[model samples]
Target: MTKAQIRQTYDRIAHWYDLIEAIPEFLGVKILRRELLQRASGKVLEVAAGTGKNLRYYPKTCQITAADMSSAMLEIARSRADGLGLDITFLIMDAEALGLHDQSFDTVVSSLTLCTFPDPVAAILEMARVCRSNGRILLVEHGRSDRERLGRWQDRRAERHAARVGCHWNREPLKIVLKAGLKVIDARRAFFGIFHLIEAMS
Candidate 1:
């Protein structure tokens, strides 16, 4: 999908996105979120922070700035941050071409977003660009399953799935991260290799 189309898709689903994701969150995504976010420190920036789902998982000491292309999604995120009583900076921005200064954030984060980005590599590169040289880039993303049967299933339906939500679920998260030229410190996969937890440095 085009970037505008993707934004419109998220804007239209912003209200029900969380509701639809609740079951998966309960099963294991929530734990993964917590695990990935716990490592964040100092000034943090969360890209494509849909509905602020990760807001509560961040360390209270870290100042957070959440950015998303969909204004409607960001509105819901703001409410979540407010409910959590956290002072967070929110912005309507493009992940592939961030407006923030380079090396400004101590930790950069993104979750379940690589699949939806129009240019996943460019977006990952932007994360590295804005992140401090000494800081970490943490990602928790879903992708093609390692299980051949399931991976084939995902491959067959990937286009149809993306039509519904702009998520290319079969894309390889780790490869895209590597293509962005960041030095990967660690990488792990779960849920039949569909979920990737990655740590990297610029």
Candidate 2:
């Protein structure tokens, strides 16, 4: 999907996205966010920080800058931050092209977002570029399952899923992470190998 398409799709879903995702089938995702996000510290930048779902997982001492392209989505994220009394700076920016200075953050994060980025490679490169030397890059993403049956299910529904949710269900997150040249520190899979949790260094 084009950036405009993604923006519009997210804008339309902003009001109900969280509610929809909170269904029983996805409740485990909240736990995944907490576990994946605990690795973050110091100055942090989060790309495609949707609805601030990960806001509560940050350490109190960490400074956070959350960026998302959709204005409507950012509004909910801002509200979530405010409600949590978390001092977070929210930016309306694209992940593929960030406006921030180089090596500005100690850690960079992107969660459940890589698949939606129009240029996942470019976005990963941008994440690596703004991270300080040896800084951590943490990502909690979902992708094609290693299990054949589930993989086939994802393959069949990938395009339709993208059309409805702005997410590419079949893209492997590690491929783009490596393609961007970030050094992997730790990597694992869970939820039947569909969810990828990664910790890397820039």
Candidate 3:
């Protein structure tokens, strides 16, 4: 989708996105929050930070820059940050083309966001680009199942699903990260095989 279209689509859905995604999304992000604390330090950037779900989980001393393609989503994020007294900067930005300078952040985070990117690989490459040499990238995503039967089902259904929801379900995110020249330092799977938590360093 064009950037404007993507932004408009997400903006239209912003108010209801959290409500509809509450159950699985909330649990999944909570898991990511715990994992992020272990790897994130200093300045951090959260790409596709819809509604700032990770805001409360961030350490108080660490600076956070949360960016999303949709300004509507960032609005909710800003209010939440204000209410919580968290010093997070919310920007309207596309993950595939981050405007930040090189090596701007110590940690880059993407929680349940990779699948929504039209070009996951490019988005990740941008994440790595903005991170310092030794900085880490933390990702939590739900992807195609590893089981043969379910994997085939996901393959068959993913395009249609993506067309409808703006999210792809069958991406191999670990492969994308490694191909982007980041080394995986930690990884975990959950939710009977659909969810993943990956930590990598550039």
- Provide the TM-score for each candidate, comma-separated: 0.97, 0.96, 0.94
TM-score of 3: 0.94
lDDT of 2 at 155: 98
Clashing residue pairs for model 2: none
Q: Give one digit per residue, the lDDT tens place, for model 3 in 113-196.
A: 778887888999999999999998988888887787888999999989888777788887777777887899998777757788
| Per-residue C-alpha lDDT of model 2 across residues 29-92, encoded as one tens digit per residue | 6677888788899999999997888899988889999999999999999999989989889999
Task: Write the number of the candidate with greater TM-score, choosing between 2 and 3.
Answer: 2
**Local lDDT at 75 for model 2:** 99
Q: Stretches of candidate 3 above 4 Å error?
A: none
Tens-digit per-residue lDDT, 100-165, candidate 1: 999999999999999989899999999999999989999998999989999999999999999887
Give the higher-TM-score candidate: 1 or 2: 1
Error of 2 at 105 (Å): 0.2
Write down the lDDT of every candidate, Cα atoms only.
0.93, 0.89, 0.85
Better of 1 and 2 by lDDT: 1
